[model samples]
Target: MSGETPLPATDPRSSPTRRISIVHVRSGVHILPREMLGTSTFGVAMKLLKWLPTQVVDRFLLIMAKMMIGDTEKYGLKRPKVGPLELKNTTGKTPVLDVGALSLIRDERIKIVSEVESLTSDGARFVDGGEMAFHAVVFATGYKSNVPLWLKDAGGVLTAEGKPEEHPFPNGEKGIYFVGFSGKGLLGASVDAIKTALDVSARWTRLSETKDVVGL
Candidate 1:
């Protein structure tokens, strides 16, 4: 690995320290052009400078990147002489959060897999005549949003839990709003906003008529 590369320096095999097992990496890890973030964009700009507070800049940068979410083709870094990186990094951990999903592993050094040999179901298959390994494989899967106890007052209202007894809405079916996760799209905030508004309006309309409605 290149010494100047942003990735934490540690051999995934065994750094004596927890180099492969734990490391602080950027949340969104993808191969990018060395010049991808040139003082022009928030995401790339913050990365360029080491003196700035990431919290103040990460959100804006994230939003900006969201605009180009799947534009990976445009940002594709040509496979080096080493051929394709075959990085499934999106399924791995970032440098900041280097812990396992269910408290599995806790290494503060750097994230890495134990060995490339373990990344397969086909037994020992080192086709490249090279041994690849990692100490930590950050499974960066998404969250499952299920409102376990969300309940509606309109006879049967659906909530976070898909039930009518759990009141997850801040306003309890009236002033409550969930502005995200309505679809598999990226606009989580927008989705939550739209749904919350619809819920509020429907509930109010029901109240105005003094008639109980069944909402499922």
Candidate 2:
């Protein structure tokens, strides 16, 4: 938690009333509840992306992004050069919830920059040929699955990148079940957990019967 800044009382994330209103509820038509995105309905929609035309999906996402932001010029920002898909593919598919992030950027309370090129004594050089002094540098590198690192026998279960070799949810290989690789986030993970539990239960019951038969 180094270099953590104090949240202002005005920030929505810090406000008790705002927090209560937003939590577990859809605040408006424009804003869908975060929980709904993890539901089965949303999972089906995401799955449909595999079959939908890339151009159509990209256009839809771009329109949605524009609708969410409305006018970028009002916030002292220019339109983004890249579409949502490119950003998602490059940075991964996690949606950033803006509690006070937009306000911070608009007020210049924090700085967003390009990829770092190298580290210097004072600060860091960026890919965009910019450098600035900093009190601290925190790496916001994306998450990586650690399954491949620790799991000894990951032959059929996981790939080199630690992703499930099998497509979609319920990915398993040789009795080894994987959760959270479906890319549907929490809902997919929950589904995997249930499936794994049922499978394991059945196997355990059969094993118990075999032991009883052998009188062991």
Highest lDDT among the candidates is held by which one?
A: 2
Q: Which residue segments of model 1 deviate by more than 4 Å?
A: 1-117, 120-129, 143-179, 183-186, 211-216
- Backbone collisions counted per model: 32, 0
Candidate 1 per-residue lDDT, tens place, 1-216, comes to 111222323344564643443322222243322223344332354353366554444443444444533232232212222211122222222222112221222222333322222243322213345443433334333445456434334445554445334445434544434454333233334555666777778777978677544432
TM-score of 1: 0.31
Off by over 4 Å in 2: 1-69, 72-92, 167-172, 201-216
- In the range 39-130, model 2's lDDT, one tens digit per residue, is 53234336657888544655565455456545533543333344434434443343333456455555544334444567678666666797
Give Cα distance to truth, residue 122, candidate 1, Å: 17
Alpha-carbon local distance difference test for all models: 0.36, 0.49
Report the lDDT of model 1 for residue 157.
Answer: 51
Q: Give lDDT: candidate 2, residue 112.
A: 42
